[model samples]
Target: MKKIFVLDTNVLLQDPNAIYAFEDNEVVIPAIVLEEIDNKKRNADELGRNARQISRMMDGLRNQGRLFEGIDLPNGGRLKVELNHRSFAKLQETFAEGTNDNRILAVALNYHMEEQENPNPRPVVMVSKDTLVRIKADVLGLTAQDYLTDRIVNMPDMYMGYLTIHAHPSVIDEFYTYRYLNVNSLHLAYPLNPHEFVILKDEMGTSKSALLKVNADGKKLEPLFLSNDPIWGIGARNAQQRMALELLLNDEIPIVTLTGKAGTGKTLLTLAAGLLKVEDERKYKKLLIARPVVPMGKDIGYLPGEKEEKLRPWMQPIYDNLEYLFDTKKAGDIEKILAGLGSIQVEALTYIRGRSIPGQFIIIDEAQNLSKHEVKTIVSRVGEGSKIVLLGDPEQIDHPYLDASSNGLTYVVERFKAQNISGHITLERGERSHLAQLAADLL
Candidate 1:
């Protein structure tokens, strides 16, 4: 049976196309929902963009029929603004001001009670992204649910950028003797993304381990067993760091996303690989890096100095990576190399809004702070033959509207995992220092 769903303001703010996503089911928009959308329509963040999108969608639907009563949707569902709800009971007794939330709850209550009075009652469900709203619905004896259209993964299944694989009985023998194995030797499950990491164990599922990368067909691609120690200089303190280098070094996979705790080598490895590709290999034309300049919990006011000094705090990490890559002898020598390269440019993501970048290596750090709309804007700016790497940990996100699962990093992982042009990895190791990894794990 077709059910009726009452949408909350947070639902629309979280995802603009949520209304149409509940296809073939009747979707009800509370009268108070419009007031909430109107209040958020002026802001510049993700919520404001979604509110504006919902407004435009509603306006376009006016051509079909009356929204106040009801209108037929393209996907075979009906939408209308609830008019029979007055919220006198919920407001006079529970809340004093008849807030939009209380008004929405009142609509759900009215619908549920109406269904109860019918001979063949259809289910009335209230959908929201607010935990408080769901709790309030429970208090009022109503069924509530989370609007989950935008979540890329649950907490457990989110890409940590690495995974351990127990090798077969002869896998270790093959790696030790041959130093490399064909893609068919490893019997991995189907549908593995290109450049994803895997650990080859000693058949016993423990002992004498080796890290490898998967080709497009889930084959053992990288077997960097060059008779010795790991890449100590680049800092693979954890197994995931070893995995990160496998992705960073491979040129076949154009796109990669690295998410990890603080002090991880996410920025360092990407910048290092980018330098190798542009300067040494001449594989790409330029090395471009950009990030949102959102300050730590506040705005960065004007700084009275040169451009480098003005952007010091926001771009400090990027500068540090350049300094390391150049092996600068003097204090200000890194900047000289940057000027000499001429191909390396650090611009704000805002400036990339209108330009088309091709045949370059682009890295967007602190990407977890971006909204779905903002990330879309940045990714669409990529032209032909360019590799755009998005690196950021959603756990360290600073955006108010984004969480671990709702941010653009996870969104991209969920949306593009199946495509051939994109690839992703979640760096689990903190290669900064022993203390850094300890703090990330225990503290």
Candidate 2:
């Protein structure tokens, strides 16, 4: 049976194309949702951009028929602009107020009642990105669901970029002696992606092993390009870090994703490789570092300073890594070194839009906070000869609308796993210190 889905303001703001996502199902837009979108349309951010796009889409749909009376959608579904379902009698007892959220819920409840009156009643569901709204809908006995179209992968089964294969002692010895192994020599459970890391262990109970990467042809496993050498004096402390370094330093792969919790060396390793490529090797003209501005708790708005000064607090983590890479022991020494080099540029992700970035090594830190569309915009801005690295902990997302599965970092990692130009590594070990690792594990 066809169902009626009531959308929340946040769903449309997260993706303007969400109205078309429900195939052959009635999509209802609460009048309050339009008002909310209008209120946010004037801001200069991704939210405003989505609001404006939704407004344009609604305006274009007006020619089909009256939205209040309902019109046929391109996907053979009904698109409606519900204006008169604002009565909150059903929720007044539970919610006690007619807020926008309550009003949206009222629309769903009203539709549900209307459906019940029919001989063959259809389902009335509320689709929202807000968890509290969904919980309230459940309390009110209404069906609520999250927008799952943007979710790419779940955390428990997320891609880890490397897999271990138990092989015969002779195969391990051949890999060690030859420094490469043919793809057909291994018994594989699944297809390997380009640049995917692999660990060949001796099955004869010996301790012999070799680390290899899927070559560009996907037909052989070649030894990692750099294992003993340190990038900017920061060596890989673990197997996952070594895999991450291989992806970061490789010119064949243009996009690399590094995911882990705090103290996993995601930022430090990325910065080290970026500096090596841009400064030491001169492969790129500049090392451009950018990250989303989402705060851990309180925002930086209360601080009094200019834009760069204001960003210093958020970008300080990047600077700390750079200081360590540059061996700047004293305070202000890193700044002096950066001023002299002029090869590294640090900025927020806000200014990166509407600009084409090329011939640079780009590092986007805290990328888990970005939406799918935001990630698309950033990746699309990468012109030829530019390599972009996205680093974040999927479990440590800060965006209200984004979670571990639906955020852009996970999205890219899942979507680009099959592409030859992309590589991904999930760092499993926390190398900061024993205490830090214990805190990450227990707390």
TM-score of each: 0.83, 0.93
Q: List the residue pairs that clash in candidate 1.
A: 160-426, 161-426
Name the runs in model 1 displaced over 4 angstroms.
Answer: 42-48, 119-121, 160-162, 182-184, 188-191, 216-222, 225-233, 279-282, 294-313, 320-342, 418-422
Worst 10 residues of 1 by lDDT: 224-233
Against the true structure, candidate 2 has what lDDT? 0.89
User: Pairs clashing in candidate 2?
Assistant: none
Best by TM-score: 2
Q: Write the per-residue lDDT of candidate 1 for residues 1-443, one digit (tens) a residue.
A: 98999999888887888889888889999978988899989865566778899999999989988888899888999898887565457434665666778788888888888898999988989898778889988887888998877777896888654567677758767776876677667765654565566676776745677776655655456664322233323546566666666666666667778887878888887887787778878888999998887622233336778766777777878888787767778888877888987989986665566689999999999998887778888888887878888988788877755678888877787787666556677776666788999999897
For model 2 the TM-score comes to 0.93
C-alpha lDDT of all candidate models, in order: 0.77, 0.89
State how far residue 51 of model 1 sits from its true place (Å). Answer: 3.0
